[model samples]
Target: MLQNEQEYIRILRSRLEGTMPHEELDDYLSDYREHFRIGKANGKTDGELWQSLGSPDNVAREIRVTHLVKKAEGNRSARNIFHAAFATLGLGLFNLVFVLVPFILLVVMLLMIFIVGVLFAIIGPVAFVFSLLQGGLPAFSSWISPLIGFFFCTGMTTFGLLMVIGDYYLARFFYHVGIQYLKWNISVITGTECSA
Candidate 1:
């Protein structure tokens, strides 16, 4: 049989009950309930209201994804972030290129910069030591003057450290922007009349 308002609410509650807190879930469901009530008042049947809202399952999935992403942003854990990204990726095929590929590239680039930063930070001291020991250890000697080597190493160290710091802020900025984008995508691209 085609679902009615109660059935629709039951399905949504079943899907979201365990994953989200009660208050939040209630707040979320209230929007749908209001939709149904308004539709009925306007002389629409339950089936029509349900159809306009789209599939209950799709609505639940969108809510789940949004909640998970919000949770990840609040707590900031790797697992949470991965789950959010993965959920976002599951939204559609377009996300494979627009979301997944960019996310992967961003993670790789951040890690590379962080590793390079740490390497240069460590190498700077080692190189300074090498320049100092050049007279005794020919192999350790730098081709440039010790003074020039000192400045170069110092600059590299500073630049690398700055890169890492900048990358961290960039990650945070992207995280916020990503959440906004996901919210928009879920609302606009989900093939449903989303509740405001």
Candidate 2:
């Protein structure tokens, strides 16, 4: 049916009711309400306004994806990010290569960095102990100085810790960027750029 402002608002509210909080739902609906109000004030009919706004279902989907991305950003969970990415991927075929490939590569890169950091963290202590033993054994001490080995082990441990910390920040940065890109993608894909 989707002929008038009330019907448009009702459909959006019903479709998004369970997925979004009441306050947030009201906030989004208000935008449409304003669009309708302004259009009517300018002498446009309800049908014309509704048509220009596009389908309520499509609008609902865009809002849903945007909300999911925001939720993932706030909570920072694997499940949340997966849901957000999956939802965005559903928007268009281009996302299959653009979104999915980059996501996979970034995840693999982060995991590899984490594993390397853990290996270094473990090996650093063992190396430190071995270096101390070298001082006690004159033959081993001739091969490498205990003091030099101690510094090297310390440097490895410090670098590993920094790598782990840096990875965390980098993940957060990418997550933020991903969310913004998804928002833009949804806007463009759905032809709701003005509303977005």
Candidate 3:
């Protein structure tokens, strides 16, 4: 069958239309057009150029992932990052193990840490207040002196606060590292290394 430039562009545009911004879609379409024009000028038929470029579906998938990753990097929003990660998964089944598994683990681990931190932060203060209001300690509390209990509770509160703060920094660090890793992974997968 004759695979013409228009047919390729149509497939690419249809795949990308709603997923990408108009200007970006136009830019990609124009780039493909230029490539075809140049190829023809160099004595390559549209079919030859199309064959070299691979299937339009595969090309569109790679382009979607690259664009999403860049948008995530630039915007630095949860929605953007999630979108990028999800788009990366579309690259292949390999990503289900590599990308999706790690992404799920990180999110679950972070959420668990945050929950523990918040629980400690709340429970420590509440226990301290109960100890004060009761004038004496309960059986479990009686194992330690009031002074020791106070110190322990204070330490717990401090630890919780630090955990929460540390978690924030860790998340930020992970975001930066994850973005770079995604870019690299996409490059390796799509055969298009980002200059940035």
Residue pairs clashing, model 1:
none
Reference-based lDDT, residue 188, model 1: 38
TM-score, every prediction: 0.49, 0.50, 0.56
| Better TM-score candidate (1, 3) | 3
User: Against the true structure, whose lDDT is highest?
Assistant: 3
- Location of the lowest summed lDDT over 10 successive residues in candidate 3: 186-195
Best by TM-score: 3
Q: Candidate 3 on 76-128: residue-level lDDT in tens? A: 98767777776776656768788899999998998888888888888777878
As a whole number from 0 to 100, the lDDT of residue 98 in candidate 3 is: 80
| Predicted candidate 1 versus true structure: per-residue lDDT over 77-157, tens digit per residue | 876676677666675676777778978888888788788878877777677777677732234454667777778778878
> Each candidate's lDDT (Cα)?
0.77, 0.79, 0.82
Question: Which pairs of residues collide in model 3?
Answer: none
User: Rank order by lDDT, top first?
Assistant: 3, 2, 1
**Predicted structure 2: lDDT:** 0.79
Off by over 4 Å in 1: 1-9, 13-92, 136-145, 191-196
